[model samples]
Target: MLAFREFVRAAYPLLSPGASITLPCKSGGGGMRPWLMLILRGRTRQFVNEGAIMDTIERAGFEVACMDEVASWADVGAVAREVDACDVLVGAHGSGLTNMVFLRAGAVVVQVIPWGKMEPYGEGFSGALAAHMGLRHVMYSIAAEESTMYNRYGEDHPVITDPDVFYRNGSNAKFYWREQNIWLNTTRFAPTLQMVKRMRRE
Candidate 1:
């Protein structure tokens, strides 16, 4: 996830305040919420990183806008308001889904996912809704960056064993890691590019 924050900085050097972000309101959930939101807002804001990637987004010129991380519904409302104020709502997979509540009707959402796995059934529905609602649902592929699994558990893990495919590899490699090059391009990322292009046109 820190890699993502670095990538955002390296990719977009002209970010600004209008580029607000609503972080996930987790207490100790090993999520990218706190750090990312703080970087985007330029102040302490009120999100976590638990001490992760903030300098990178700052270097890129964006600011984080976090809401409270209290144990109540009011905190949710605050996060929602912060999300609604952004031009783009950037988030990790599951946490990104939560941002939907805060997002203004047509705000663009960029969802980050691991590199090489088949797209899940539910995500397709979300994409369809994004298309219909004029909200851009961009997919950020992690394959190119080499982020497979984190030491701590999170929901963004790739589902590798589908009966027909065995793995996302178009090849017959016995292991998923061995077929990385192929699966990274064909399965893990093509649809993400497709989604981005589709959203851009919309």
Candidate 2:
């Protein structure tokens, strides 16, 4: 596997890094607030209800900011500097999660897990990456109703009802990764934000 540092240095060159995002809540309720950097996906897969995510974060008592650079192979140093400023880096399972390397030590990496492929790509992979970098890792498993797949395939489709059946092969696995986007069930996901807020204190 390519080293995390090496992968970050060579991300796409077209997209420009967005304005530095910062978290506003620190500790459970003290010290400088911790910032959450939500890496927005520019292409197909996306956080369809981003406002809800920000609202949930604020409600969880952490300052949060969204950014547009994760898809771009932009300036690595600039991205690193901005990531270092944040206390948490949150993104869905995708290349953008690679930004975990830039996080400050003890900062949290919160992965919004995608469907079917949740185990390896979503939580397991990055949890290992976070540990390798001395960072904390958390996962928000998207509920079936929250996934676009639920609507497209309807609740009965194998992918929606039995993801294990859907992910039996590599081609189907790719479909899960490429076609699925999340309409986060913020009510359920809020606890995850609260979890990250608690992690910020330590």
For candidate 1, the 10 contiguous residues with the lowest summed lDDT are: 38-47
Which ten residues in a row are the worst by lDDT in model 2?
Answer: 12-21
Residues 21-134 of candidate 2 have per-residue lDDT tens digits of 443222334445667788888765688998877877766767676667443366566666677677788888778888777665678898888766576766557888788777
Q: Please name the candidate that would achieve the greatest TM-score relative to the true structure.
A: 2
Q: Candidate 1 — which pairs collide? A: 34-47, 34-48, 37-64, 39-64, 40-63, 40-64, 41-63, 41-64, 115-143
Q: How many Å off is the CA of 66 in candidate 2?
A: 1.5
lDDT of 1 by residue, 84-134 (tens): 555455544432354444444445665554434534522674555555554
lDDT top scorer: 2
Q: Candidate 2 — which pairs collide?
A: 11-73, 12-73, 23-35, 24-63, 25-33, 25-34, 26-33, 26-34
Q: Score every model by TM-score.
A: 0.44, 0.80
- CA deviation > 4 Å runs, candidate 2: 1-31, 69-72
Report the Cα lDDT for residue 53, model 1: 34
